[model samples]
Target: MAFRRDPKTPAMTTDLPQHVFRLRVRYDECDPMGLVHHSNYLRYFEIGRTEFLRSSGGRYREVEEAGLYVVVVHIDCRYRASARYDDEIDIVTRIAKITAAKIIHEYEIRRGDEVLVQATVTLAVIDKTGRLQRVPEALLT
Candidate 1:
């Protein structure tokens, strides 16, 4: 489901496409102490971004077939709380910024209203030859 907007959060203004993706934490996602492994948060953010792209009619296969790919340029995840196995989590994703050749996505991993992780990922639109290219116009709308 998609969130209408969060009036209180400056980040949730009406301009960008905000997508919410939900998932259940699997047993393998946790560590010996039972908290989700730090690296898995990156994976969750990826899932959130991919789903967001899908809703915008941006199919990865179609993009690749057109000889374009979204390749990660930067990622930063900040841990705030712990996530445990079997927990139902939500990954809130939004387009933080879009330029001629790149897109930036912001993500929040939460268990209910409690945020477990916050992340920002930057990706470049690259061609099959690995050279930067302009982001597709369809993705911005």
Candidate 2:
């Protein structure tokens, strides 16, 4: 997703095709110390992936209804900074790699270019019966 920057703000472009999923840190996702709970980063990664797919002309539900689902097989998150309640964060995500049955996505969570978290996730396409399946070509397009 693109942020609506002030007209005076210069834009930065990159070769990496990515989606920016932005959200505010909610009270329920924060700890007593006002820092976001560590686990919530995983959720942000997922949101990043989902939005990336959607914005790129794919939909998670469409694939699921066709008997395919992307299941997280592995995840690694590195916290670089802490986020507290009401902090607006942008999760930048891209498809790092794709294979017949699996795909990898990379993510970086930022509060206006200051990365607060970075993560990588591996996902596999599987059917309801747990049989491996190929990712739809539409998703790769």
Candidate 3:
């Protein structure tokens, strides 16, 4: 898996190719204790991945229009810390692996210098009829 610290770091520029997106924890997304709800972290990860794809020159709708649909096949997350409301978070995502019909993405949710969550998600491309299909070359490049 490609892992980059920051976009400008030499290791990031030469060794890894990943996307990073920033988000703010909203008051409405938190529980009464002021910590972000567990479920909402998944939503945040999704948004981060979507934005990563967008920056890579593709969008979910466009992929669907091309007869391809990505379905989440697996998701694993570990919460290491807590993020309170109004915290500025960084969602870092990278392509962990790619196969004929599947892609794996790894994510890290950080509040400043502290990592709050780490997740790995796997998605498979399928046709409308539910037959597995290879990811489009256009999408990869």
The clash numbers for all candidates, in the given order, read 0, 1, 0
Residue range 1-141, candidate 3, lDDT tens digits? 333335443222123358889999999999999999999988988898898888978788988989889999999999999989999999998887666677788999998889999999998999999999987765565
Which lDDT values do the candidates have, in the order given? 0.83, 0.82, 0.83
Quality of model 2 by C-alpha lDDT: 0.82
Please report the TM-score between candidate 1 and the true structure.
0.87
Question: How many residue pairs in model 1 have overlapping backbones?
Answer: 0
- Model 2 / residue 55 / CA error / Å: 0.9
List of clashing residue pairs for candidate 2: 1-20
C-alpha lDDT of residue 75 in model 2: 88
User: Per-residue lDDT of 1-141 in model 2, one digit per residue for the tens?
Assistant: 222323443322224578888899999999999999999999888888888888877899888889888899998888999988999999899766666677788899899979998888989999999999887766666
State the TM-score for model 3.
0.86
Error of 2 at 31 (Å): 0.5
Candidate 1 lDDT over 8-100, as tens digits, reads 542222355689999999999999998999999988988998898898777778878888888999998889999999999999998876667
> TM-scores, in order shown?
0.87, 0.86, 0.86
- Decoy 2 TM-score against native: 0.86
